[model samples]
Structure formats: C-alpha cells, structure tokens
Target: MPVPELVRPAPPPTRPGLALPRPAAFACTGVLLGLFLVGSTTPSPMYALYQQRWHFSAIVLTEVFAVYAVAILAALLLFGSLSDHVGRRPVLLAAVVVEIVAMAALGFAPNVGWLFAGRVLQGLATGVATSAISGALLDFQPPGSNRGPLVNGVASGVGMAVGSVLAGALVQYAPGPTLTSYLVLIAAFALSLLGVLAMPEPVPHRRPLRDALRPQRPTVPAGRGRTFALLATTMLASWTVGGMFMSLGPSVAKGLVADAPYVVGGLTVAALAGVGGITQLVLSSWSGRRAVRVAAPLMIAGLAGVAASVLVGSAAVFFAAAVVLGVGWGLMFMGGFRMLTGLATPEHRAGTSAMIYVVAYLSASVPSVALGTVSTVFGLTAATLAFAITAAAFSLVAALATLGHR
Candidate 1:
C-alpha cells in the first residue's frame, strides 16, 4: 500500500484579491471616465443661475470657471503619474472620494465663495483622475487593438453633452435645482466608487509612491517632436472652442433666444458635444492625417457660421453652426488622441497623456479668462465673434502645419 501511494499534484496559482473580469473592468473604466467629465461640466448650466442668485459680475463668473481649470492644471502636473507608480484603483478611489466632497460643497453652497471652493475641489479630483483613468483604459483594452483613444474621445464628448443637458433640465424643472443636481451626481459618484474598488489593478509593475509624487514637466515622447507639435497645435485650437462653450455658450444662447427655457441653453451645448460624440464614433476608423485635413475646413466654416449667427440673431443658424463645429471638434480631438497614443509606450502612457492634457487645459483656461474679460468689457456677442475668429485662424495654422510635415 505504501508503494502504491503516488505524489499529489499542486493546484494552479490564482491571481490574488477580488477584481472584475477584464472585459467588465474595461467597460466600467470607460463609464468612470465619462462620469468624471459629467461632474466637471454639470456646473455649466448652473453658472447663469448662480450669477442671478448671487449677483456676481461676468468676470467673477469666469473666475469661478478659471479657478477650476487652474486647479485641474496643477493636479495634472503634480499627480498625473501617481497611478503609474501606485495602481489605478487606488488613485481612482481617492479621486472619487474627493469628488463626492466637492459635490457636497456645491450642493450646500450658500455663497459665491462656496462655489469657488467646490469648483477647486472638483477640478483637483478631475485632474487627478484624468490620466489615471485614461491610462487604465489603455491597460484594459484588448491586446493588438487600438480602440482606447476612440473610447476616450467619445466618452468626453458624450459626457459633456449629458452633463450640460441633465443639469439644465434639473435646473428648469426639478425641485431645488442646484442642490438636486449635485445630489444626483453624489449618488452616481458613490456607485462609481464601488466600481473602482472592485476593479483589478491594471498597472503590473509599479514604482515607489514617493518618487512619482513629484511635479512633472510636460514632455513629448522621444523623436515625436514634429508630430507632438502638430498635435499640440490642434489641441490648442480645438480646446479653445470647447472652453468658450463650457464657459459662455449658455449665456450666448440666452442672448439669442431671450424667451427660451433653460433647457434651450443646455441643448445648445448638447448640439455641439452630442454631434461631436457621434462624429467621433463614425470616424473612428479614419487615419489621423485624413481626419485633420477634413477637420480644418469644417472648423473654419463652422466658426464663420457661428459669427454670422451671432450677427443675425438666428438661433437656427447657431444650432446648425454648432452641429458643423461639433463634427470638426470631434475629428480634431480623436485624431490628435490617436496620434498621441501611438507615440506612447505602455510604461510612459500616463505621463504622455498628462502632457497633452497639460496643453489642452491651458488652452481651455487662459483663453476662457481672456474671453470673459472681453465679454465684460465689450459684451458677449463681440467676445464670441472674436473668439470664433481666433479659433478658426488657429485651426488654419494647424492644418497648414500638418500638411507641410511628412
């Protein structure tokens, strides 16, 4: 009997800890990315309401928006690579917690100061999450697939569109408009937190946390200078258009349709962002070079239509122009994102993504503040026209630059 005994085989090793399957994790990460942007733009529809309630000047309103962008920039530069050192789940969890606090601040705000506080907190949370979530997206994407950038572009445009319209509806029809929207966001974010907790760690090899905490300068990947420069130019032009809309599009809508409902203002933003999201989906298979070539002319024409709509006081024209511009915006963003991701390796993915966002938020923030100043001094119409013209000019330059390059 002893001689008949045989050696037992060991069981196969299993991955430690509870985590979602990779496919589910991939989808959840995309939703989380959308949710973060949703939180970021939810306040857009509330700006006019805040100004009406608190009696703040246009400059002050813009300051509120500017503060958020600046906080985002700071967080992006400082904590962008932290997820690469730690894991995606931890960074996302912490950011969501901070976002919940930010939402609470806005939900209960009694004064303009509270608005600033809430926006700053929201910005920090968003900035920190952006690179981490984006990197996680890349990590979870199927092997040999390039769907990550497409997901990023589509999620951002759709999130912004949803946020603007959702907040507008709540503000116009729901009880306690300001408080109610934040309450909904708080609940949504809570659910997202649970999702993050269950998500698997995507970063396989991590560096020490202390080293990754240092501030990082934005850097183009090696030998990617010309491409990076062209992409940066595209970012500057495209995001400037986005910044203007998020900050003042609702107000501009108010001017165009004086008797329109709050939802009309929201729809104005939705037109641009929703259409853009659809365009991204449809054009996902296009090459970056071809996309940009098409984008340049459409952007110029759309901007021109926008200016004319403002002059003629035509809401129809404005909406039409927004649709055209949305297409261009989507193409520009998707193309730039595709090119940028191609330039990055897995190890430096988060850092590389952060660098592009550094360029983006800068364009979004600085020009928005300047446009606000112009609005305060000259009026919203003049400022919008000038902004459109400037954006179109930049788009022209970006297209030419791309064409000249190989």
Candidate 2:
C-alpha cells in the first residue's frame, strides 16, 4: 500500500535555470529582510518634517508611529503563517509590491491622513515580508548550520541603521526631504520585486489553506513554558528600548544637542542598530544562553547611561549609550530566538517565533505614545528618564527570569 502524502515527505524537486544557487538564494533572503526594514524605518527622520509641515503635536506624532505598529501586529495575527499555505515566493513578491505602493503614498503625501495611510500600508507589507523572508532563510540553511537566526537579526539591524542614516542625510542635504527618499526606496523595491520573481520557491509542500490560515495564538509549547516566558520578557525589554529610539530618539537628541544637524537625530538610531549588527556578527558563534547572560547587565548599564546623557544634555554620552544598548539589543534578540528555536517542535516553531515578535512589537508600540504624551506635559528629558527606568525594570525582571530558568 502506498503511504499517504502527508505521512511521507517528498524529495525536493530541481528547477534548473529558474532557481538561484543555494548560497546566492540564502544571501538574497537576507537582502530582502534588510530592504523591508529599510522601508519600515525610512519614515523616521521625516517625522520631524511632517510635524513641522502639518503642525501636529508630539501626541499626534507618536500616534502616527503607533499606527504602523498596530497595523503590523494586525497583519501578523491575521496572516502570520499564510505563506505556509500559499508558498514563500508568492507572499514575498506580493509584499514587495505592497511596499512599493506604500512608498509612492509617502512620496506624494499631501496631508497627515495620507501619511497615516502610507504608514499602515508599509506596516502590512513589512509584516508579510518579514515572516516569509525569515522562513526562506531557514529553508536555505546548510545542514547543521545555525546561521538563520543570526542572519535574521543582523539583516534587520543593518537595515534600520542604514535606512535611518541615509534618510537623515538625504533629508538634510537633498532637495526633496520626503519625496527623494521614498523614490529611492521605490526603485529598490521594484528591483527586489524582480528578484523575488526570479527566486525559486523554498517551501515545496503546502498545507491546506484552512489549516494554514487558522488564527494563530501565541503560546509556549509544552515543556517550553519557562524558557518562553523568560525570553518573552527579554524581548519586551529590548524592543521597548528599540521603540523608544526609533520613535522618539530624534526629538530627544534635538533637545539635547545645540545647533544639531538633521543627521544628529538619525545618528541616535544608527548608533544603536549599527553597533547592534556588528555586535551580533562578532558574537554569532556564542551559545544563546551565554549571549543572554551577557545581555542582561549590559541592558541595565545602557539604560543608566541613557538616563545620564539626558540629565547631562550631552550628545556624545547619548550616542555612547545608544551603542551599549545596541549591543544588548543584538544579544538579547539572538539569545532569546536561539533558545525559542530549540524549545519549539518543528511543527510549532513558526507560530512560536511569531508570538515572540508580536510581544516585542507591542512593546515598541504602546509605551512610546505614552512617553510622547508625558513628554508634552513634563519634558523630553524627564520623560526619557522615566521611560528608561521602566525599561530597566523590565530588563531586571528578564534577568531574574533567565537566571531562575537556567
């Protein structure tokens, strides 16, 4: 009797001339991740411009940022595993197309409403593309290799750093602050869309749509509850710091640095992400648990430094703090992800991973708007210090959780 299709795995089929070589395909997946984040963060430096042009308050500014986070979360919840049913390449291509449209919306944005629309579209595109790209990387990994998680973290960090730095420079010196950056991104996405079309599908076997499209709830797999809880806390802590930098770091920098250049604001984010990417690369071979162990203290120290920088009103100190936080961010994510990957069954890995991200992005979203509103009432420095303290508390909790779990 023949075995059922679901019971036996099929051999991977060859696609001569249609598929990229394995190494090249793997590298392209990383590139796609970088580009998606590049689009996601390209709007950061421009927020100041938007505020100046539209006369919106800080509360409104954060709301704009929060909308993207909310949209991304919505997409993840709704279609987290959609690629599993439909295939990775199609979802990736569709996402890039949506990103292109979002870029165009930003380029031509005439009002605050248009900016919100563009942000929402960008969020949806990024949420879709991130899952597919990360999954593709794992599919293409060499046997016994642990490069997938590292690549995922590094690509995102590199993208955030590069996108913010480039956008800031362009906004300062280039003729079109808002329009030019999006134009460049649009061109990049157009090229990426072509690349996605050319790449072969990595996930060969597909499950039924009904099964794959089922609403995903973030849950810790059996026997993984303790580790998952700790890691979730680590993610929440690190992502809160990241969210603060991405959403409000620029404004905070502006308040501190006298006669600051536009690039100064972007520099805060760039420092965190660039240093983070480098740190992850340098420490890629370390065990995930070791990485987390190193990350906890660094997180506390970095938060302390940020608070000090705010009190002293020193850009150098702020930048230094950003660098330290970047290291923590890199290690924290890598460690938690590695641990999560080990604990989850193959069948449940994707959903488990998505749950972690959902938690992290939520951390990035809600507190930032609250900080903005508080800053409006109190002051940027006071608000930053308060936020840093809260983030530190979470980091300490994560540290305790990790220590107890091990």
Candidate 3:
C-alpha cells in the first residue's frame, strides 16, 4: 500500500530543467577561460603587422600592450568579486558579450587608435571574467579534488600558445590574416555564450548587486601577509617572464632569424607557453612550495641562457632557453596559484584571485613598457639583456624569500 502511494512518479520533478552536469560545467568553464587568453594573445603575432601598417615606434607598441594590462587592473579592482555577490553566470555572460565586441574592434580596425580601444575592451572583458571563471572552477571542483589551480595554470599557458601559433599561421598563409583569427575567436565566443547560459550558477546566495559594485582594495586574509608576500613575489617573477615573451618574443625571434617566416614569431611564444603547459601537467603532483623553490633557480639559469642566446644570435639556443624558461614558468605558476587559492576561503576566493592577478598584470605591464622604451633607445639586444638581469635578480630574491619564510 505504501509502495502504491509512492508510485505517482513524484510529480515529474519540478526543478525547471537539468543544470549542466558538474563535469561538463567544469570543462566548459575551463575552455571559456582559455578562450579569453587566446583572444588576448591572438593579437601578439599581429603586432608586427600593425607596426608595419602604422609605422609606430617600439615604445608605442609596448604602450598598446601596457594599456591592455592597465585596463585589466582597473576592471579587476572594481569588479573582481562581483560574481560572489551577483552570481557567476550573469557576470560571465556580460563579459563574454563585451569580449566579442572587442574582437570585432580589433579585427576590423582601420587605425592604431582603434587597436588601443579594442585592447582596452578586451582587457576589461578578461579582467571581469578571470575572477568569476577561476572562482567557478573552485566551486565546481569535484569533491576531494585539487585540479582547479592546475587547470588555471595549464589553460593560461596552453591558450596563449594556441593563440600565438594559430594567429601566426593565419597571418603567414591565410587571406585576411588580420581578420581571420579574430573572426574565428568571435565565433568561438558566440558558442561560449551558449555554454555560459546553460552553466549552473555556483553562488547559492547572492548579496545585493549595488553594494558589490563598490570598488574594493585587494587584500589577503589576516595573518597571511608573509605567505601572501611570498606568493606575490613568485607570481611577479613568473608572470613577468610571460609578459616579456608575449610582448616581445616574436620580435626577438625575428631578430635572431632574419629570414624566418611569420610562423617563427608564433613559435617563439609557443615554445615558452606550450612547453610550460606540458610542464605543469607533468609536475602537478609536486607541492606548491617545493615547486617554487625549484622553479626560481631554473628561471635564473634560463634567463642567463636567454641573454646569451641573444648575444650570440643563435635561434637554436634561444628556443632551448625558452623551453627552460617554460618549465620554470609552468612550475612557478602552478605552485603559486595553488598556494594563492589555499589562502582564500570560499567566501573570498574571487577577490583573492584578483589580488594575485593585480600583482601579475602589474609585473607584466610596467616592466614590459620599460623594456620597450629601453629597446627604442638602446636596441632590442641591450633591452633584452637588461630584462634578463632584472628578471634573474627577482627570481633570486623570490627564492631567497621563499626559503627565509619558514
């Protein structure tokens, strides 16, 4: 009798429709995050093309790059934790739409001013999406799993690599080199919008949107200042390397191999990013602190190798040094991110993630702009040597600090 009473099929389960399965959601979120980076770097291979078309100075080129980083910092400071209050899906959806507009601006632009405008838009979109997407990965992570940071690290490096390589090939071989890559990105983002629409909102109880919109200063949890400082140091060192490669690797490659095809520029970036991605996966089992300790020295050595490669004009040596740098970059990123995420509770995950990126993009932007200016005045080789020395010194300090901190 009881069984018969329960046989009414439970009213067809009125839950409004199934949410995207957690596994699917996790994968989709990762892919969307990667797409954002891909969009950012897709312009890297084309910077030379832009310079050729516009006759801009190296300083101007770096300014264009620096502007993007500044916009990202502005957005990150303002909207970093917004998703924690208003829910992830809405924030992500809006950002993606903005990203599509940015791609269009870059792809169809008639002048350098439009390029600057497009980069600012793209940077805003990326900054808004970064915290939300990274937070979503943490929210959707499988129970007892620690894959969130790994995914973030790997996605970043791999995405940049794919963007650079794909754009390079398109520029070298495709008809509409400047337009094709961004069009592809536009279409990819359009599909990502659908995925975001379907993604389940991970934030269960959202706060008031107006209050969340207030700009918040970046902060670490109380009593974690030393840990935060160490992590910041590591991030600064690692991401600065990334910044340099992304902004100037192609140009450096061209300098080394004068007759190489456009694809070499992309390969210059891919060597660092692609190898870094693989290194992260291979070293996923290592502890964060240990990875950083090991990575710092490797980075120092790699920087020395890079400087030597430039001095000798050896493309082979440059690529090899890039691989070394990639390994160091991958380990430091993975380790530092793991530590960074550990510093946050679920309540403040997005804000904390934003703070680390603030450090990262700052390192990426300021020094890169300086390097560009130096290149304009001193020459690329001299600028690169200075960059190498500075980066190596930072790496040493980071390692020493990490060791001294307990």
**Residue pairs of candidate 2 with colliding backbone atoms:** none
Expressed as tens digits, the lDDT of each residue in 20-123 for candidate 3 is 98788889999998898888788888888898899987878888888998888888778877887888889999999999999999999999999999999999
lDDT of 3: 0.81
Candidate 2 residue-wise lDDT, 1-406, digit = tens? 0000010122244355675876777888888888888777778788877888999877778888888888887777677777777888889988989999999999999999999999999888888778677677776667567676668777888888888888888888898888999999989988887778878776667888788667777666887786687768877887788888888888888777766356777787888887888888999988777888888889889989999998887888888888898898778766766665567776776567667667777788888898889877887788899888998888778767767554
- Scored by TM-score, the top model is 2
Ranking by lDDT: 3, 1, 2
Clashing pairs in 3: none
Q: What TM-score, over all chains together, does every model reach?
A: 0.90, 0.92, 0.90
For each candidate, the alpha-carbon lDDT, in order, equals 0.80, 0.78, 0.81
Residue 10 lDDT (model 1): 24
TM-score of 1: 0.90
**Colliding pairs, model 1:** none
lDDT of 1: 0.80
Model 2 TM-score (2 dp): 0.92
